[model samples]
Target: MTDATHRRPSRLPTRLLGACLALALLLAHQPARADDALMAGVHAFLYEQAQAHGEDVVIEVRPPSARLPACEAPQPFLTHASQPVLGRVSVGVRCGAEGRQVRYLQAEVGVIGDYPVAAREIAPGTAITADLLETRRGDLSRLPRQAVLDEAEVLGQVARRPLAAGSPLQAHQVQARALVERGQKVTVEAQGPSFRVTREGEALEPGGEGERVRVRFTNRELVTATVIGDARLAVDL
Candidate 1:
């Protein structure tokens, strides 16, 4: 009745104390309905549905607007850096939300200050198989430099008898086993120690003694020998 009825009852308790302080700051920033931690590992900039693998994202680790450049001989996983970066990182992962109130279940291996990375490379190590995360480039490196049949090199034998391992190289009945160079010489018509040829070439066909004869030399190289008979004519290397 006076002062507009006491300011309409004091504006309804000041709008009910500002609606109870905005509902307690939105329930204290929500997120925690049981907390199983659905997933999180965004080391930095990542969007294609959070690098898809399961995708359900809601990440918020904070503190990496960008940082990717620190792999000098870092050849372990194959790609993380080899040169060319503006902001390097290594944790990266995402996927969470659906039934809980706020979770991020899987994605460990994080450290912007220590460096650990080995939780099975991020979950995986219990007899793991799928070729164990398969990845082969130079695979293990080494054990691939023994196919050097030089000295006129050119071999492809197995012209008339046996030839396994996906055999398929027939040139006029296969016959060109060339290789014998050190001083050069041929003609041994089978027998005992007649040694004298330093080097020669050609005869990449005709197999016997132990089979597998495909030699053709002359700096051409195509060897595959095994037949050490028929008087080899000369073979120093």
Candidate 2:
């Protein structure tokens, strides 16, 4: 009788397979881990945008409660581009190169920055001087909508209504001082990348700085231009 020794097949491969299966199961239940990265990406984007406006931003990002498909390469943008980034906002996010997954996120952005306030009691129709305006630091997110943030925006402008001392000014509280009058000869500057052309045009309507006014050129060409300064208008070509 010949003695034959049988060798047992290795169980190492079976153990490795079992580990992989366990990992897959664990990952399936923890889909929100990817969402954590997604929200982080969203926060970074919002923080950068807010920083561009010269504000110290504190962003509170809220993740979606529902489980979402595993996402990679997340991109975030303002859902309403015209709306201010402060306070509670809705952000739209796109995932992957194809952007096949689109999701909306809610967030609260605290913007700490300087805003213009009345240095003293301002009466209506009073021309705002630098002495009359003071800078106040606070969370701009809590300010009234359209609150003035830049001192340049109010300097030389006229108050539309009475403002209390040390109170933040809003867009409705002031008006740009009228600089161009109707039928006045205004210099219409058409500027381009390479050159600038200026022509004299009669203003069809009165406009203040940063306001749009209609101008009629000598050739009877009517165009709308922005008032840049006193009797000055510009058109970008």
Kindly list the per-residue Cα lDDT of model 2 for residues 1-237, writing each as its tens digit: 999999987666888999999999888768767888888988988888787555688999998978888666777889999878888989999888988888999999998888888899999989999999888888989999888888897788899899999999888888988899999999999888788899999999999988899999999999999999989999866
C-alpha RMSD by candidate, in order: 21.1, 9.0
Residue 94 error, candidate 1, Å: 3.3
Per-candidate local distance difference test:
0.31, 0.88
Off by over 4 Å in 2: 1-29, 53-56, 182-204, 214-237
Residue 53, candidate 2: alpha-carbon lDDT: 51
RMSD of 1: 21.1
**TM values, all candidates:** 0.20, 0.71
Estimate, for each residue in 68-140, the C-alpha lDDT of model 1 and write its tens digit.
2222221112124331111222332222222122211112221111111112221211222222122222211
